[model samples]
Target chain A: MQNGYYIGVDLGGTKICTALVNEEGKVFKEVTVPTEAEKGELKIVENINNTIKEVLGDVKIEEVLAIGVGSPGPLDVKNGLIVETPNLPFKNFNIVKAIKDVYNTEVFLDNDANAATLGEFVFGAGMLTTNMVYVTASTGVGGGAILNGRIFRGSTSNAVEIGHTTVNIHGRRCGCGNRGCVEGISSGTAIAKTANEAVKSNVPTSLKNYDVVTSKEVFIEAAKGDRVAKEILDEALSYLGILFANLANSYDPDMIVLGGGVSNGGDIVFEKIAEEMNRRALKPIREHCKIEKAKLGGRAGVLGAAALAITELEHKNKKDGYIIYN
Target chain B: MQNGYYIGVDLGGTKICTALVNEEGKVFKEVTVPTEAEKGELKIVENINNTIKEVLGDVKIEEVLAIGVGSPGPLDVKNGLIVETPNLPFKNFNIVKAIKDVYNTEVFLDNDANAATLGEFVFGAGMLTTNMVYVTASTGVGGGAILNGRIFRGSTSNAVEIGHTTVNIHGRRCGCGNRGCVEGISSGTAIAKTANEAVKSNVPTSLKNYDVVTSKEVFIEAAKGDRVAKEILDEALSYLGILFANLANSYDPDMIVLGGGVSNGGDIVFEKIAEEMNRRALKPIREHCKIEKAKLGGRAGVLGAAALAITELEHKNKKDGYIIYN
Candidate 1:
């Protein structure tokens, strides 16, 4: 029931970002450190604790109510455990307990994608709408849904795994052991892989000059009128469109916000995906939705994690018979 | 709120099914009538009224709490209006107003599939779990979602349009003007059409002997070891598997309940779909859900509509500052 400041941590494979945020969700200070995941769980925990300490600076311990960590998932949110993240080194990492033991404050943990979606809903592109789906096409395609202004975590709190939904049943093998999942076709890794393969196959393209073609290079080449690059982008965006359209039909959200590394390829990516969505989806499904880029940018992860902490505190307070104040 | 009996009406293209249901979700009396939809909205409304009156018999009006109707949709549930049902004779039909005017009682209307899901959750296969997806593979694939023991109505109460979700980007055209939707490949209509086309295309099969091929006959033939029939069934079931897996990934529901005519093909249908789901879906996604047959059967439509009435009454009473009790 205590109302005060909160700490939000965005834990990634390579780095940890932490911020001290007030009740109104404003960040007073922020800090970051390398995860050095290969050094394992102890090193990662130390990095997280250090980042939080650096972010807090001289702030009094009593001023902070809770800490929220948005880490790589499929997490056991109920148990406050990281089940087995694809990128993170640890299995069954008890992040909440570790943070609470170190900081002596309440800790909340959620999927990084879910945290970012909440951040967008609370402070970014989706602030105007209560219902939204946030899709981040980073190294992987990740999604989170906001329904009636609350995170729509499914039965096991591991729902909204949009990337794993199959778009092409007979297509490429996904890391999750599925064939032609949207993540395998439309994510930044997928785009880069598609480009690299096209080059290796001796396709007549400017992309062949690069030893390792990134998603950025492909989009840049496509914009400059490289036919092969445009084709690659088109294929990826088409599948991304199917994914978005399916989401639109399934959830009927008011808006879809696109974020992550690949989204930086700019309006062409959005335009192409939106076009495919409009063309492929039934009229009613596509009509009410606006496809917009995430406005919170890189800050979404920390802000969202912070927001999750605040949200969890509110839920806890309500459950304990305390009245929540705006 | 006043704890009393309610009425449920399932309005379909072919028939109108009505039932008088008590607060504890028991049906006291039931009646059915042909829709005769081509005779237009007024005639359809008359049929609906007659059916409801017949179902009520000698029951006192004051004892009835409210009426709930489940009709073919994409409906405007908020306005209690049938926005534009493709099968019905009328567009923009105010069904709630019509029923309320004739009976002089409060009325609520929802999509038939949504009502059926609620019915299943409230009284059938889904009663054991709060998070569920109900798929009816009837003439067309239809779906409804139940989350946290309440209907998961999306932004416009048009959420969970599972049928329209694309299973294959390069697959068949759906009636909803989308290509490769699950409804285009897995619905009863799709099975029959595929069978009829196979027969016409000079495929050497037992199905060629029948002038009019039905989805049931195809299943029967498949059971009797007809290769063409088995192939057709396999294709349809594979698409259905994709559809189910997609739902499993998207919602992470505790259970998926299958209802409608095609499901009567029985364990083979469920088995084939489960096999495909297990093979194609990520292990964690497929591991948590049990896909089972709908227990409510023919009673689902009426019961769901009735549940909708009670639920609506509860919400209304709660909103009006009244505490509801059974």
Candidate 2:
């Protein structure tokens, strides 16, 4: 395998973080810049290019292999186009072409969660197992799957719309206009909303003292033995476990890696999840998979992007040419 | 594309039925015999061999292009051996070798549900789609997945276990030692148990007329608009809908083919399922996919077995005289 430097960019709604990663996933250089997305598509393009240049910083750009970008969906990942994204200002943006304009090299593109899964598969907790699922519990429970050691993007780019998996047929109304999705029931936003409602409903909760109760505040209070906080935590954990059990029952993954802000609850969350999953999931698999905290922290997204860059390059080399056919 | 004669053997626990099928999946001659499984494994082997001979009595032996067998599981389909099956008396039965011994020809084997799906995929309602799911709603929800035009047996050859999918965490117990499996809530056997309990629990409504209540009796009363019957039917439908919706959401198959005796509820059941799936599934796919009645009916298992025989032969031919490893 050829070991070379490549650029990995995390294209967020408000900012862009670009890094120069060697083949071994070591970040030699990195930097960030404001996306200024509202200024129009041109500004976002210029910003990504600028961050890329800064990350490269005369580190023999001629030797660098490819550039990878992880963005929100539903994206046109095949064409490297951002299609109808909710968070970013651009729609149907030819991101790969734009990055090519700046770097004049090979480029890799995929959904943020997908890139993150590849990152985990090759370099994180998922490194030990091939069949696995990684879910990022941010605003919503975005997910990506590695089935049989490959990212399983269905015939379309939208295969693992896992957050949309119907955990409850008649549960809470999800943002996707469905009910009882993992995201709808136990997202960070959902947990905060539940806490707020309980406080307003005079549920004798410690969360009433917060300016606005969030998932973080609830976890902190729950650790202190507050009844309302404990109840809310229990509710969220059970729903998350059910969601994991669903994934386990269907795909029979060897491991499920949890990421994002909500996972900060640590052992309290992990123990409950394992217990509930063992109770709900089919035997052996429920006991088979070891659900633990993610080894990659906040930098998981960036590291995943780098892994995507290397994997795409390696796959291209395997086919004896850089055939970018989707 | 080649059309020829094929032998299909329904290797059941109690009976062995063998039929001769032309390229059109039309049976020209058929024969049946008691399995006599209690006579031990050798007698059962003799029963199968005699059934094949009787089915093709007048025809030349060389006229048979392929031999296929459909039997219960869990089985090592790849190795042509039956594993520990709950419905059968034999353990670790080397079915392929046994059949090959009598005929001195190629014999193919598959689990019953897998065979059923292949039958539907090639010659039934699923003919239009390369990807589909066939679920048999009998004692338990035995199912098979046709993914990308091939039957998908996961790492263990025991995938597509539709009955065990957990629909509710705090719901009924399942036979597979899991909580709230789709089978526990909606299988014919599970439904009959629920119907019996409701009638005995003395819910103030109709359906006490039958001394022994069953899933069939419940359906008969529900068709007439009885309140208790309606309630039981509704519960069963809701759970079934959830199971179907989850499969739809997860796999995004183009069609779902329903088989087994319970599917005789037919339009009444499908109409209710359509209503719930449309209201519950993720957007777009919510309206996507046609849930249709399976066309292969009683002979599905045999035809599927034949299809598998042909497929296995073709797959073997693809690797230049080398068998492709799964």
Candidate 3:
């Protein structure tokens, strides 16, 4: 009997990352390609299929037990459908069914953030703990909660949307129509928007030098001792600190792992966030939870999907007549 | 095989409520007595012992499987000790060991909020759904979460502290040293405080007639078409609505059951909160979740503790050669 392998795919607005991994979660083969999401749903689905096939390459087809896809959401995870994604031009697309039809194999789909959380939990920063909250501060702030080593999918499989949980009431206008959400104030997009607005206001800062101020440039300026840039970044980080503190008090997780673009600010960002979290969170959480940076970088998405596939594979084995090959 | 019974104790600052219940969650007997907590820890422990004995009167000792207690927290659940309670004069008191020594049977302990959530989940408003959030709006807002029909204790067994989660960034000073927590704006005490502050400001209202305005008087005045009363109550209810909406987004529970003193404000409060929640929450949550008043009244605490005992009994049966009778 051959030990089974898994295919993990991370589908994004601009790119699709896929990999082939064994039960041990070691990636021995990988592939990446542009998603070209603007081309429409069919093209995107076809691209996903092609990416998986490319990753499979010369491997024995029957040896691959399942495939896991981490896609941008809102999604219908239970039914394996992409409900509607802001970045991707897909609405109610049955990506899982399409892939299953071509490969005739098992498929699992979850929100990209949740998948990355699992990746971090199974193979990266969260390896030391069973319960962890993974926060991604990318173009948008996204969150995933792993409770008891399993993703905490609430009634609608959309729970743990920590980014949207209100940190400031009636403070800022969020895209989702909420006022003062973490996403509205602390996301990379939010930081870039703040910096751009400051430029438009003719703020006395070196940031005016950039044609378009990115969150990265703002961090660089802040690092170079720019007062205005420091103020904007500090405000954003403070809101994040408050958000994390609130999460710690509510969820009381073992560890909080921070990831994404903004987190690349390195030790300064991590230490500042930890101090703010400790100062503001409830007494118990301040003493108990460890705040840390996510260790898995580019591979978190695919690895997380692979981990999900492993979980699903085990569930399937217990339900069906299948047996695990060790 | 003989069927088992459970004894549950609800320990409060002022009273101790104890009950005996069968496996099906039907309460057969109960005993209530003053805690006289200020008399000190020894007297409080003796009072708890007496309450248990009174509830156990005329019962066959061999049929009782375990005893469960729901006490005021922030306490150590795993070790069965009260960390420190503001109302009760106890510091690191080993209440569980004391009870266990008396009964010599399996004993379980949890915070009152967690127990009440279980009570609601097992036999009250939460009986209809597997995943429910129980929010108590008494002296302070307390919350408990039941996921897949089990209590969701976080990594440190201190999860679901919903009241402490911030809603307004700088709106109100919470007792926990946070700004704008649900407990600071929406609890029964919070409502009363707001009403009193309005009175102190010399607002022309019927509330001035009372020597001390309570949350109930505020509700009564609101019902009588008092503008200030209505405004105060509306503001409190709105904050609660924001909180519930945030919780719905965070936990995505099938239902949110409201209990305790403030929740007793009836349909006006319930309908107003429901309307505000629907107005603010995401589309899917607005469509899926049912907001309802808690059914179990005075019995919530004792029943919740009883439910904890049942869960512990089952866990014990699965582990250490203990058998459960059908």
Candidate 4:
């Protein structure tokens, strides 16, 4: 029982990654397959089940404690339903029940952000911290917090929508229809968008050498000492810094773990973050809260889903007065 | 005992308010006295003890469950020391030890903002809510939160420094040395500063008739259709709205309770807050998080201290396996 396995399913529009993870956060078996989203709802769900089956391998279903699925939202996590999402074809689909019908074990469902946060809390950079905020600076700025040793899913389970929070009162308008959202100014998509605009405006830069410029090219050009690219990154990372500083001021967490594409911008990303935090965060908070890079990289999705299962199972066992062993 | 009594002390720069509160959150006895802060550290401590004594009246010290004191920061709450604040004369003073010596009971100390948050959570506007954020907008803006039915005191107990969180990056510089902090723009002091600046600039306004302009004067003038005053309030309240919207986005709490002087500006303040929240917050969050005025009013500080004692005692009892009756 101490060596029990948990199944994790990372449901995405492009692919469904399923893994069997052991108690020690090791992947025992795993399989990844195309989601084939355009092939229709039932077909995609079938693909998910197939991946789960592939990961199960020779292990008996009884040896698995629980299954956890992480997906893009809006989701009815309490009822284990994927209400709807832009990428996924789910519309009021009961994903947990569908998985449970075949496996007949306990299942948990959460948004990808919360799952990733749990992953960091349990086995990644946020390990051992009582309060941690996991921020993903990808195409959008989204986050989740583990507070007081538990996942904090605000009143409507929409807590930690950090990207939507305003940074500059009269700054750029966001797709969410808000002005000055950090996501609108600092996310990977935003950075690339700014670079493309600069190129279209014929601003003097090495970014124009590339037929198309993305955040990846901007980072490369900035590293090569391109002034325009450097300025774009400086502005974007400064806003990112403001976002991090705001988190430090608000949560006063033990650490803020950075994840997603933009976080991988290396020294420049961390340097800007540190600079803004020093300038903006309260003295005590800045000194106390550690800023760290997320440990999980490409495998974050699958591992996060696995971590969700392990953590939720532990919570359920605790509530049911069952002792858990290492 | 279910009928237990607790002592609450609201330690402010100008006054010391002490009260005996019952299990039902009702005040049994109360006393207010001048802090005489200029009389030095030991004198302030003595004054605090005297107020506690006055509030105790004929009740024996043994009947009191615990004592809670709420004061200005920067405090070392874990060690129960007043680390030193602007108006308070105490420097590295262990006020908790002094109070404990006099009463021989458990003593708890927290920042005034956290105490007020506890007050709202236990007996005021935030009652019956599992997650609530209490924001005080006065001469300065400050706040605290009760998350998952417990006070979330981050790593260093400085959690929920919402005022210092950036609302308008590149906007006004805060006294905290951070740019665009909500406190620098939305607070009563900030409002007064803006109005006074407008008056000094000889803006065409009825505010010129007043020899001195405070936030109260600005609110009055705005209510009376003074355009300049109205503009000042609109600008300030909009930033306040951003702060509130950020809270809603980050915490997704059940409710945000507004307290202190500026919150009393009535409809104009609330309308601005609502408009900003609608314009800024995520749809799900905006639809769910209720914005309410603090119920404790002028008595927030005293009652908040009481709530802190009660909440902490409940936490202690639960941890020690002692069941709370109320």
Q: In order of the candidates, what TM-score does chain B achieve?
A: 0.93, 0.94, 0.93, 0.96
Model 1 regions lying over 4 Å from their true place? A1-4, A86-89, A320-326, B1-3, B102-105, B320-326
Estimated TM-score for each candidate? 0.94, 0.89, 0.93, 0.96
Tens-place lDDT digits, model 2, residues A212-287: 7789998999999999888987887787887777777666677889888888886778877787677766664666
TM-score of model 4 (first chain only): 0.96
Top-DockQ structure, candidate number = 4
Tens digits of per-residue lDDT, candidate 3, B293-325, equal 888799999999988888767766656322222
The structural similarity of chain B in model 1 to the true chain B, as TM-score, is 0.93
lDDT of 1: 0.85
All candidates in order of lDDT, best leading:
4, 1, 3, 2
Residues B77-109, candidate 2, lDDT per residue (tens digit)? 767788766656778888888888789666888
What docking grade applies to model 3? Answer: medium
Tens-digit lDDT track for model 4 on B1-326?
24689988999999999899986679998899999999999999999999988888899999999888999999888778999999998888888888887888778888999999988888899988998999999989999998878888888888999999887776688999878898999999999999999999957998999999999999999999999999999999998998999999999988999999998998999999999999998899989889999999988999999988888777776673111221
lDDT digits (tens) for residues A168-194 of candidate 1: 977788888778789999999999998
lDDT of 3 by residue, A1-326 (tens): 12689989999889999999987788878999999988988898888889888888888657798888899888888778899988998888888888887887788888898889988887788887877999999787888888766678888877877778777765568888878778888999999998998988967998999998999999999989888889998888888887788788778899999999988986657766887676667777778888888887989889988877877677666663122221
Candidate 2 reaches a DockQ of: 0.40
Fraction of real interface contacts that model 2 preserves = 0.31
The two-chain DockQ for each candidate, comma-separated, is 0.68, 0.40, 0.65, 0.83
Docking class of 4: high
Clashing pairs in 4: none
Candidate number that wins on DockQ, 1 or 3: 1
